[model samples]
Target chain A: MKPKYTSLQLFALTALRVSIGWHFFYEGFTKLLNPNWSSAGYLNDSQGWFAGLFHAIAGNQSLLAAADFLNVWGLIAVGVGLLIGIFSRYAALGGMLLLAFYYLSHPPLMNASYSLPSEGSYLWINKNIIELFALWLVFLFNTSSIIGIDRLLKRK
Target chain B: MSNDAENSKLLGRRNLLKALATVPLLGTLTYAGLKKHSNTAANNVEVLNALGFPKNTGLSIKPGAVGTIIHNNNPHIRLGFIGVGGRGRHLMQCAGFAPPEYVQDWMDKHAENPDDNRYQNFLEQDDLNVSVIAVCDVFDEHARLALEAASNADKKGQKDFKGITVKRYKTYQELIADKDIDAVVIATPDHWHAPIAIAAANAGKHVYVEKPMTNNVAETYELKDAVIKSGIAFQVGHQGRQTESYIRAKEVLDKGVLGKISLIEVTTNRNSPNGAWVYDLHPLATPDTIDWKQFLGNAPEIPFSPERFFRWRCWWDYASGLSGDLLTHEFDAINQVMNLGIPHSCVASGGVYFYKDGREVPDVFQAVFEYPNRDLTFLYSASLASERHRGKVFMGHDGSMDMDGVTSVYVDRASIKYKDLLDRNLVNPDEPALTFSSATGNIDAITSPTAKYFAKRGLLYTYRDGKRYDAAHLHIREWLDAIRNKQQPSCDIQQGFEEAMIAHMATISYREGVKTYWDAEKEMIVKGNSVKM
Candidate 1:
C-alpha cells in the first residue's frame, strides 16, 4: 500500500531529508578530500559510557583507519541515497546508526563536558538526538516515494 | 489508442522528471563544496604563512621512529653499559631492553587503559640493530637488573626465555675493553664519566656519556681532547636534543622572530625528598653487596655509609649537585637553541636552606650566566622544597617565547617587529601570537582555554605519534647513526665541552662566592675576582 500525504506534509518531509543529506554528504566529501583527515581526535575526545570503545578505536592506527574509511564512505552513501530517494530506507538506517554512534560517544548528560567544541548548548536533546529522531521519522513516514526517485522505485 | 498513448507518455515523463530532479542539485552542491574547501584552504594557508609557519604544521603527529633516524636500515651494533642505575636502566629500556618489571608495568598500564600503548610500543619498537653485549655497575642489584634487561629478548617482558650471554663486567674499563663491544654508554656518576669515556675513546670505541660531561675542570678538557683524538662518534646524553618542541624552538629562534633576545630564564622546582636527591637506599645496599671503593672512585676515603652511595648527588665529591645535574639540562636545551657556547662569566649563590640532612650541596640554587657576545643573560634558578612551575622563557625586545612544555610565542604589547600585525589587529597581545603546540602538533594560536584543557590532561607533550618518544632512545639511535654514517651526533664533543665548562663555572661561582670569568683567550675559569665565600 502507498502512503498518502498533503502537499505541505510532502514538501516539509522531503526538505528535512534533503537538508540532512546535504549535511552528511558535505561532511563526508570534505573528509575524503583531506589527506590529513582522521577520526582520531573526535574519537579520542569521546566522553560518555562508550568513550572507552571510541578511545580504543582511536588508539589503534589500523582500527582508526577503518573507522575513518567507513565514516567517509558511509556519509556519502547515505547522503546520495537520501538526496535522490533511491534506497531511502537503507540510507535512513545508516544515518540513524551514525547518529547513534555520535550521540553515544558524546551524550550531553549532566556532569559530562566535551573537549571538542560543539555547536550549541546541549542537555539531553542535542542535535544528534534530534537528528536521530528526525531520521527515524524519515524512515517511517518516507515522502521520497511521492516526491523523489522512490516514486520510480515503487514500480519495481 | 490515442488516449492510452497520451496517458503512458505522461506517466513516463513524470517518472523521468522525479528521478533526475535532485541530480542537478547534487552537481551544484559538488561545485559549491569544491569552491568552499578550496577557499578555506587558501585562506588558512595565507593566515598560517603570515604567522610565519609551514602549512603542514596542523595536527601533524609524527610517528615514533628511532629519534629521527631509521635504525633497521643500518647494520647491527653491539652495545655495552657502564652504569645500570635508574638512569642507565631507563636508557637501556629506551634502546629496547625493557626489564621484566618494567615490561610488567607497561603491560599492566595497557590493561588498565587501552590508550596507554607504552607496553605495545616497547614491544613493537623498531629493531635498532643493536645488542646489549655486556653490563657494568658498582652495585650488585643494579648489575643484576641490567643483566636481566640485556637478556630479555624482543622486549616482550616474558619469563623463561633463552637469552643472550650478557657478560657482567665489574668495572667499566673491562666492559670498554671487550673487543665484541662496538661502543659503550657511560651512565656512570659525574666522577666516572670522564675516566670511562676517556678510556673508551682511547680504545677507539664510540661513547655516549651522561650529562655535565665530567665532574671537575681538569677532566672537562681531558674528555674533549680524548674524543677529538679518538675521532669516534661521541654523544653527551642531553636527550633534550631529540625533543620535538626544542627542535621547533630552534627553528623559530633561527628565524629571528624574537627580535634582540636579552634575558633567558630557566628553572627547576620540586617538593619531595626524592626530588632533593634523598633517593631510597635499597634494603640490600650493604658493604658486601656494593663495591664501596669502586663507587667512591677517586674520592677521599670514607666509611661505606650507604647514604653516600645511594644519594650520591648530595656530595660534591661525586655529583655536581643541582648545578651539574639540573642546570646542565636547562643550559644544554638553551644552548641547543641559542648556540650560546660557553658563557663569558657566571655568578651564583645559594645554600642548603631546605633538606639539611648532612648534604654538602645546596637545596636552593641560582646561577646567572652572562653571554656578552650574544648580548643576553641566561638565568637558572632552582628550589627542592617548592613545587612551582617556572618554565624556560626567552624575553626579547619584540616578543617573548616560552618553550618549557609547549613552544608558545607572545608578542610584546610595545614592540618593533610586530607593530604592523598588532596595528592590523591580526595578532592579539592578550593571547599567544603563535604557538607550536605539543598537543596538536600545530603552530596555530590556540586559545588559552583549549591549550590548558589538553595540558591538564597531560596531552600537551612532544609527540612520537602523540606519545612522546623515549628521548634517550632517539639519542642512542642518533649516536649509532653517527657511528655508522660517520656524521656528527647532535650533542657532540664540542657541545659537551661547553656544557661541562658552563656547569663547572656555575659550580665554581657557588663554591667560591665569586663572579667566575671565562677568559676566552686563556680558556680557563678565573674565580679570584669576586668576594670570597
Candidate 2:
C-alpha cells in the first residue's frame, strides 16, 4: 500500500519546494551575468581551515582560468534545474553543494563584525544560515510537484 | 493569610508527598524551561540590538540617501566641549557650534581677563553654536588660554558660549569624576587616548576620542567591550568616516557595480615634513604642569623624555606611528565604505629610512591583508620626503575607487562580458559556398554562417561617478539625536570596535613580521606569533 499524506502535509511540502527552488534559481541567475568569476579570488582572501584549498587554487593559473567557464555554466544549470523541478532532488542537492563551496570559500560569518546583536552574532538566522535551511527543507519535504517537469516526466 | 489557612486545611500525607515530590520536580522543569527561554530571549535581544533594531520599537526601513542629506528624527544633544586645542578648536569655530541663550551669557563674563585674538573670528559667526560649557586641560596655561578665548568670545556677544566655564583639571581623572559632564572630547596625546576613554566609559560618560582609538591591539578590544556593556555612545574621531561620498561609494560597491571584487589597494602618503611626523618641538612643555606620568597611562614605565611626551606619535610606547594615526583613518574609511570588518589575515613589512628622531615605529610601511570577501594591499609611506601615490585607491574586479575628501568610483567596461559568447567553437566546420547572381557577375560567399546559431554577443558595460561628502557634523548630529530619542546611531560602539580591531591586526602583522588572523566565532585572533603578543 502506498503511503498517503494529509492535505496540510502535502501543502506544506509543496510550499517548501517552491520557495527553496525559486531562491536557488534567482541566486544562480545573478551570478551568471558577470564575465569574470572565480574561486581563486575568494580562496586567496580567506583565512580559515580551507585556507590551504584557496591558496592551492590561487597558485593554479590554468585551473583559475577554467573556473570562469565552469561558474557560468554551473549557475545556469542549477537555476534551470531548480526552477523547472527537472531532476528535482538532484537540483536541490546541487544548489546546496554550490552554496557550500561559496560559503566555505569566503565564509561570510568569519569576517563580519556586528555593531549590535543583530549584525554579528551567528545565531539561528543569517544569509548563509537561511540558504542552508532552505536546502535542508528541500531534503526534508522531498517535494517535486506543481509547475514541475518531474511530475510530467513521471507520468510519461 | 487566607491562602495559608486553606493550604493547612488541605494538608495530608499523600498531598504532602505529591507537593514535596511532584511540585519540586515541576518547579525544576519550569525553572529549566524559563532559563532556556531567557537565554533565547537574551540572544534575540542581543541580535536585534546589534542590527540597530529593537523588538518593542518595531522594524524601521533604513533610508538609502547615499549622496543626499536626510534630516534624522533625533533631539538636539546638549554637547559639552572639553578640549579647545587644534582639532577641537577647529570643530568649535564651525557655524554649527553655538548652543542656546541661557548658557551663552555666562561664558562672556568669565573670559574677560585676556583680549585673545583666537576667539575673535569664532564669535562673529551668528550660527556657530557649539556651547563651550566646560573646557579642561592638564597644562593650566593652555587651559587658561582656552578659557580666556571662550570668555572673550562670550563677552563679545557670542551668546552661545555665554555660560561656558573653563575648569582646570590637573589630570583626566578629575574630568572623569565630574558629575555634570555627560561626555568628553579627548584630544590628548596618543598614549592617553585609550586610558581616558576607558575611564570616561567607567564613569558613565560617552567619549568621542580622536582617531586611532588606541595605540595597541589589546586595548582596542577592551575599550570596545567596555563601551558596549556600559550602554554608552562612542564616536571614534575619524571625521570623514561617515561622509556621503564614502557611504555612496560603499553602496555602489556592495551592489556589485565593480563585479565580484577580489583586490583592494589602499595607500596613505605625504610630501611635507609636518605630514611626515616632523613637528617643531614645543619649548613650553615641562614635567611640572604636563603630568608626564599621567600621560604614560598603561604603556611600559619609562623615563620622561620631552620628545616622547610632546611628539608622542614617534615613540612606540605612546603610539602606533603613522599606521595608527593616518593609515587608520584611511583603513576605517575603506572598511566603512565596504562594510567589512577585520581581514582574515595580514602580513606587513617596512622600516624607518629617514627622520632618526629615535622613534621606534618606521617612517614607511606596507601590508597585504586577506579579508573574507577579498584581499586588501595597504601601503603607508611617510617621509620628511616626497609625496607620491598619496591618496587611497580601492581596486575591485568590477571597478576602482580613489578617496580624497570625495570618493570617486570608476569602472573598466570590458570586465563584465558574458562568457559563452566569447568562446570559439571548433567542434563543427562549415565550408563557404560561392554563388553568382544571374543578373550580376558578382560572386558572394556565404558570410557569417555562425550567426545562424548561438545567442547575440553581449558587451560588458563600464560605469563611473564621483561625489564630495561632508558627514562629520552629520554623524555627530545623528548620535546626539539618537541619545535624545533612545535610538541607535549609524556607527555605534560595536561598529567602532570592529574598525579598531582591524588596526590591531595590522599592528600585529607589522610588529611580529608574520601573518595575523582572527577567529570571528571565538572573538580572538588565531594563535600566531603576532596574536601571541
lDDT tens digits, residue span B1-533, model 2: 99988777676443434223212332343356457546644654543342223546642312233322334533223334554455565454441442233134434543662323224433433332234446666555456555555444443444324444555566677767877776667777676677778888888777777777776667777788778777777777776655544554554555454456666666666666677666665567677766666667677788767677656778777778766787677777777777667667766777777767677877777766676545444444444445665556666564555554334444443434212211322111122121111111111222122211100110111111212222455455545545555555666666667666666676777787767787777777653654431
Candidate 1 residues A117-148, lDDT tens each? 67689898799989989999999998777767
Model 2, which residues run further than 4 Å from truth? A1-156, B1-84, B94-130, B149-164, B301-303, B372-384, B418-471, B527-533
What is the TM-score of each predicted model, taking all chains together? 0.82, 0.53
- TM-score (C-alpha, index-matched) for candidate 2: 0.53
What is candidate 1's CA lDDT for residue B345? 87
Consecutive 10-residue window with the lowest summed lDDT within model 1 chain B: B58-67
Model 2 / residue B475 / CA error / Å = 3.8
Per-residue alpha-carbon lDDT of candidate 1 for residues B350-428, written as tens digits (9 for 90 to 100): 9999897999999999999888788889999999999877788999888888886567777888887778767866566
